[model samples]
Target: MASEGSTPQQLSDDFTDLQKKLQVVIEARQRLDAQLSENQAVQKEFAELDDDANIYKLIGPTLIKQDKDEAVMNVDKRLDFIDKEIKRIEAQIAEYSENSEKKKAEIMRLQMEQQQQQQQQQQGPA
Candidate 1:
């Protein structure tokens, strides 16, 4: 079943097409894996933040009724540091989300481009 009309260029194009498709799949999988790792890191950070909040709660009641000014001052200093830490964590979370969105968009664009190339190849003369 030999087709005498088939050109070597067509066969080469087909091999290139398969290679591009495989590359796209590999890149997409890598992106997904990176996203998952980022998500886990975010989750771990949130857990640590929750632990800090619990510490604040545990100390709040004891510090409220204390008459020692020096002790109160120390507690206030610690609380200020905690507040700053919370703000920093919020900023980090926001940055992570923004970066994640950008990565997702990039991956989507690449996938669409790959699909369009495959379609064009299918429509081209054999």
Candidate 2:
């Protein structure tokens, strides 16, 4: 509940801030999710390569030849890091989602209270 002297304007501003924060979290989560999927696909591709197959990595404008085992190792390391980041981002999303719901509820409750006060004013001398 809003404390005494808390104007409707302040409450509205607070609600809007939460909305912006929620959107930012959602966008970040989406980006991490896409990256996670891409890394997983790369990991699968690396797994399918034969032991003797050659690998090339693009460095700037040049295609540099890389050892097959070395390429697999690099991809595997990236995959592990991406997996961890994905989990962390998911946890952040869950926490922000809960906060978003709570803020929305609080805004609703405040609006309802304001409406009641207005109604009471209009029904003066009751």
Candidate 3:
């Protein structure tokens, strides 16, 4: 047979664990957002450099123009990789948020059940 108060303790533990998981997910999302912002700044700078390099190609000497063209190509490749990484992180954040919300609802339901059980027990024979 089940004990009288064990259910409440179990529900409390489950709620705590759910809260901790949500906190971790929120921190991870913040870190990803910060990384995305930094990558965007770098991408913008790379774009500006690419534009300047293209302009130099039209008027500068042959060797200088070739070097600038190569640099722009490398920056373009790096920007493409960053874009892919940002998309992956965004997808992960969406998944984590969804899971966290579900867990929160479960915890709430468990707590309510525990409360109802306690009330029913209190109303029974002493």
In angstroms, how far off is 117's CA in candidate 3?
A: 0.5
lDDT of 2 by residue, 1-126 (tens): 356566768767776776787788778778877877887787788789887877799999999999988887887788788778777867877876777677677778878998999999999976
Runs in model 2 with CA error above 4 Å?
1-5
In order, candidate lDDTs are: 0.51, 0.78, 0.61
lDDT of 3 at 84: 73
Candidate 1 lDDT, 46-120, residue by residue in tens: 445532242222374563433334434555565565455556545654654555455445545556777999999
Task: Evaluate model 2: give its TM-score.
Answer: 0.82
TM-score to native of every candidate shown: 0.45, 0.82, 0.55
Which candidate number has the best TM-score? 2
TM-score-wise, the better of 2 and 3 is 2
Give the least accurate 10-residue stretch of model 1, judged by summed lDDT: 49-58
